[model samples]
Target: MKVLIIEDEKELSKSIVEYLSEENYLCEVASTHKEAMKKIGIFNYDCILLDITLPDGNGLKLLEELTNENKQDGVIIISAKNSIDDKIKGLQLGADDYLTKPFHLSELTARIFSLIRRKQFNNANKIKQDELEIDLLAKTVVVNSNPVALTKKEFDLLIYFIGNKNRVLSKSTLAEHLSGDFADMLDNHDFVYAHVKNLKKKLSEAGCEPYLKTVYGTGYKWKG
Candidate 1:
């Protein structure tokens, strides 16, 4: 999953990024409200850790913008303020959860997982499609009761395809989703083709049907 940490405290942002990266989440940080808005305008994150206070503006304004844009990203407010009014305002602004500054990283991680699950999978930990079974908690994929060994990128690619099944996905879209902010530095999407090829080969070897289809002169789609 991808996460955006909108925090001004450098140390706290670093710690959160390190801890969440260890938990297999792709993380990006924005210290100011302007930077946060830029990132939000360009990329789609699975969850956002929003701090109410920022150098440029209040995080609540960003939340309001997200609501106005109809963005589906799950947001969790993390601030030092514990006042009931602030909490109520944050929730009313459409935040999924709130965490005080002096909180455990483990608890924060659990909250992100819960928020993503509720938003993406209807709170289900396991996703079963035909002979394929994916355990979101375990981060494992199995086909026909046999394990499929997929690299982290490949697994992420598979999940992305499954999540948007039957929709035509451009190479640029896949590249941006996979590489996040770094995608702009990339000159081409050769890596997208490579990951899709590897994923298709692994699933084919595991006796699964060819659900991934390539659209000539366009991009790719998951027919599942």
Candidate 2:
């Protein structure tokens, strides 16, 4: 998943980014409200860790803007303010969770997982589609009782497709998910096609029915 962390504390933000990146999450940072706003305008994030106190503006105001935009991204307020009023305000403004300052990184990570599970996976660790099953923790895929071998990108692509199974995902969107910031540096999205082709071949070779479908001029979808 892609995450945007809006924390002004450099050391803390770096630590959070490093930890999440190690877990295979695409992460970006915004130390100021303006920077965060620019990022929110340009790219979509699965979740956002927002600090209540920002240099340029109140994080709560930013939350208000995000809510007004009807952005579907999950928000978790991370702030030094331990006031009940702060927590209540954030929640009433559509924040998904709240974390006080001096919190353990593990706790933060767990909260993120919980928020994502509730937001995308219906609070489940396993994602199921027809006869296919994926263990989120194990990072493995099984189809018809047989394990399917998948490279990192292939696995990420498959899980992403399964998570939003019925929606048509564009090549650009796939590239962003796989490559993060480097996606903008690429000249073409041929890598996405290559990965998809390899994944399809592997699944087929493993005797798994291919549910991936190309939509002519648009994109691809997993219709299972």
Q: Relative to the true structure, how large is the alpha-carbon lDDT of every model?
A: 0.92, 0.89
Compared with the true structure, what per-residue lDDT tens digits does model 1 show for residues 120-172?
Answer: 77899998889898998899999999999999989888878887889999998
lDDT of each residue in 91-112, candidate 2, tens digit only: 9999999999999988998898
Best by TM-score: 1
Backbone clashes in candidate 2 total 0
Candidate 2 vs. true structure, TM-score: 0.94
Q: TM-score per candidate, in order?
A: 0.96, 0.94
Model 2: CA > 4 A from native: none
Candidate 1 lDDT for residue 35: 98
lDDT assessment of candidate 2: 0.89
> Candidate 2's error at 107, in angstroms?
1.6
Alpha-carbon RMSD of each model:
1.1, 1.4
Error of 2 at 52 (Å): 0.9
Ten-residue stretch with the least lDDT total in model 2? 202-211
TM-score of candidate 1 to 2 decimals: 0.96
Clashes of each: 0, 0
